[model samples]
Target: MSLYSALYSGVSGLTAYSSALSAISDNITNVNTVGYKGTSTEFSTLVTESQTFARYSAGGVRAIPRTLVSRQGLLQSSSSPTDLSIDGAGFFVVRNSPSATAEGAVQFTRAGSFRPDAEGYLRNTSGNYLLGFPLQVDGSVTNTGNVTDLVPIRITELTGTAEATENIRIRANLQSSDPLIPSVVAGTYDVTNAANNVATGGVVPNFSRDIEVFDAQGGTHTLSVSFVKTATPNRWAVEVYAKPASDITTGAGLTAGQISRGTIAFNSDGSLDVANTTPALLDPLNIAWTNGASSSQISLNLGSDSNVDGLTQFDSVSTVISTSVDGAVFGNVTGVSIDRSGVVTTLFDNGLTRDVFKLPVATFQNPDGLTRLQGNAYGVSDFSGRYALVDAGTGGGGTISPSTLEASTVDLAAEFTNLITTQRAFSASTKVITTVDEILAELNQVI
Candidate 1:
């Protein structure tokens, strides 16, 4: 009985050493793999108790494979902006399929070598799609750390974008010595009358400038700004109307092609007097587009309160200075970039950028207990605590490093040493089996 038990124990020893050698080989092979964690085999003794006091039974050894998943690796820089790596602690939440939203299918990974696929979805080498929360047009996201809110990051859908004009700043000078319109009042004029309206070409403006304003649909519209000095001293009647009167329809309290009609009051010293101006500069120009676009409230920056800037009243000839409008034409997608906070911004050829999405980091209590899956990903296991999705660098999550990747944590020297030790252990186990065989043969001959 003792001999049989000894023989079985030797076989078990051989199996344990074999598993160790296999683990060492795997560690050595993945030394250069990106975000690869090394595995090592640990041995524990298995004992069998004998029924009789004098007899003893030997049990085999068992090998337990442990992964060093929480170990940090060296960060290497890359040229691509999509490459990312965790600097502190945490993994990127991902999914195998772009449309997969099941909580059980969610995965966490340290590998960040991601690139846009044919459909403009960002995925890693193993086809794992990156997940994030999409931002609204107002730059707001209603993310409450819920996993269901995550969606595959797709950048190509943002084909062409147009920015609506938010504000218009005019810095031209108005001639103070100009005579007022003889037929029209200084501050009040009929917008519907053909003989006095600015949109219908009824009254030629003393000083007229064309300004281009962009709509939400990226359509550009020209606005004709006219200034007619009134009989009132230092007061001018201003009317801003859209060109090609069919571009827009009049809203309440306005006429056709009328965007805004106001009166500007200037001090005797050529400075703007905001207290006397009708339709105060604080009010924005309300415009309702005929095309399918949201209504716009255009802010006006005419001039300063005291300085001779913006819409200035000077005795010299009215000179048209530079006018700046805040809006962009239709801009095509040029590229995308990510920041340390995991905010993905889309770049446009028209020099416009928009915040599109934000990546979330998942942290666990015991990362090593995570189940290692194919393609170097990890799934939540019973041993691993529940994951908490958080913003990058917040709530113990790791900060993202753009244009960088984490190298494998396996050490070549250590793996080589372990390989040699495992090899010797296997040889000794084989020797034990051969020695047992010889002893058994002698016992058989005696019997």
Candidate 2:
């Protein structure tokens, strides 16, 4: 009976070692796999009571395979813009379906080799869609960090719309040493009067500048501002013209050659006096376009009332320092990129960048307890606890390193060593079984 048990024990040993060999083989094969975790076989002894001796028993080994899921892997640099890796604790939230279909279960992974498909949804090698929080136009997260708030990041609809020019800020210096324009009377000057043209033996503007402004429909129009020195010290009369003054005829409302929009007055210090400015309340210039395009209201900010942050009058040559307008033409999506904060930015052909999505990193209380899944992914388990979906670099989640991938955690050298020892153990178990068989044959012959 004891000999029979010995044969069974040897068989169990052989099976245990075979399972260990299998685990070692798997580890060696996936050494280059991205985000791959290695597994090892854990052995335990099984015992049964013996009739003759109370403490004596027949025991055999059993193998339990466990994955080293928490082990960290080295990060490798990648050329792809969507490749991402976690430097610390977190997983990228993903889903199998692009449609938020209730049948599809959510998954987590560290294999961030992602690229947008034809539909602009970011998906990994396994075809799982990457999920994140949608960003508002102002670059703020739209929803709380909940599983339901996650959505597939799509950039195909990122073509920007045209924005009409509403505000224009001018920063320049007006020459203080310039002589007053001849034939220009202060407080009684009229921009439409024929006496104001120096070419026609009247007064002419000391300086003038023209800039292009866009209408609501993105049509370009030339707006010219002419400055004339008045009799009053440091005073200059500002007149806005839709075209050259020489081409316009003096008339009420608007004549065929009428080009004057309105006039503004500046103090001796070169700062705009808002109260005394025309269009009455320092209002925006309302241009009535003769072209087929609609009219445009443009606000001209010369300088602040309390500071010289805008236009200034100084004892220097008249020069245009800088001019900026808030507007952009319609453009198509050109490229996409991710930053350290995990914000996906879409670049447009109109030289504009928009934050389309904020990629959230999911972290667990016990990542090692997560259930291992196929394709280098993981699923939720009771031991792992609930996940905390947080912004990258916040709430214990690691910051994302764009264009990098995490390498497998398997060590080839260690796996080879394990292979040698498992092979020897398996051979020894076979020898035990053969020895038991030889003993049984001898006993049978003697009987």
Candidate 3:
């Protein structure tokens, strides 16, 4: 019986020690594996009586070891535009929904090896869609409270297309006592003597201008505007006409119906005061020209408003003030820049511009607790907690680079060392079995 008890004790030791050695070996093998954490065994005696004092044999094996948490490794940067890596905290959310369901298909990961999917969505290498709020140009995410489904990155050519038209604003002071019947003249006015015609009761002798605007089909339209001295210095007439092409000869002929006319007036002080009558043909026509596609020319004659009582004197006026017709045409996209707040602005090819969108980032509570899916990604789980939304360059999340990537984290030397230890431990366990066999043989001989 004593021999049997000794044999059982040896067997237990051999089995427990062998299991411990296996745990160590596993740790060593995976030491070099990315995102892998090493593990060790914890041995607890079996439930049984000790045979040394009462002749009863000890029974049962010890406890086994398991891996608990994987340590967060250092992040290596590849600087690739698509490669993203977290520096301080938070895990990237991923979805493995083969059917792309809203709630059920979910996972998470720390790896940033992401690419575009079939639908042009930013997905991981494993075809898993990444989860996050859509980044806007302003570096702020839209509807940040809600989480977006797995999707691939959609990168359109940052290049955008644009068209532009310029509305030339012209304001001129025409004198009230010139023999001109019209207050405003819009057309090629063959000014007999523009240099000497400078007259006024507050009206300049002559003022003329030409503006360019784009048609619906992107064709260029030219508008000719002119202000001539009428019969009265304080009452000058206005005229407007449209030419389809840059060369006045190539443009459509201006008809009386297509023509616009108005009047300009002045005060006793010789300073020009402008007001147009309600029936002025150019007032409505100019509105249509600036707002309409084909009708290019528009003229407004500002007749004088008579309520004057102050020391209003005028000497030589060079600039005219325009109260109506305020609009512009964009050229094309030429430049792009983002501010710290994430506001995206685009300069047009024609010197025109506008704001596009805003961009933002997200954070999680227990990033390590996230569930890993395919393609080095992770999804939110009960353990991982909720997402904390933030703008780009805010908190710990860094700004996104236009062209960059992130590398992996693995240790090779540590794995090899663990492998040797496991090998020796395995050999020692085998010797224990052999030694027990020899003891049994000796006991038989003694018997």
Q: How does candidate 2 fare on TM-score?
A: 0.83
Minimal lDDT window, size 10, model 2: 247-256
Query: Each model's TM-score?
Result: 0.83, 0.83, 0.50
- Model 2 misses residue 381 by how many Å? 2.3
Candidate 1 has which clashing residue pairs, if any? 186-230
| Residue 355 of model 2, lDDT score | 82
RMSD of candidates 1 onward, in order: 4.0, 4.5, 9.8
Tens digit of per-residue lDDT, candidate 3, span 1-447: 545555565577667767776766666554444334345566676655564664665453564664433345655544344455444444445566534566436554555566655554555566665554445544444544444432323333244533434233344443333344232343323222222222112224355555555543344555555566554445444445454322232213333223444554556665445443326432434423344355443334333344332111244442354533333453544445444443444556655455554434456665556554444555567986876656556775445433223333334565466557645755664665677689888978997
Winner on lDDT (1 vs 2): 1
For model 3 the local lDDT of residue 25 reads 65
The residue-by-residue lDDT of candidate 1 on 308-337, one tens digit each, is: 778889988987888999888899998899
Better by lDDT, candidate 3 or 1 = 1
Candidate 1 similarity to native, TM-score: 0.83
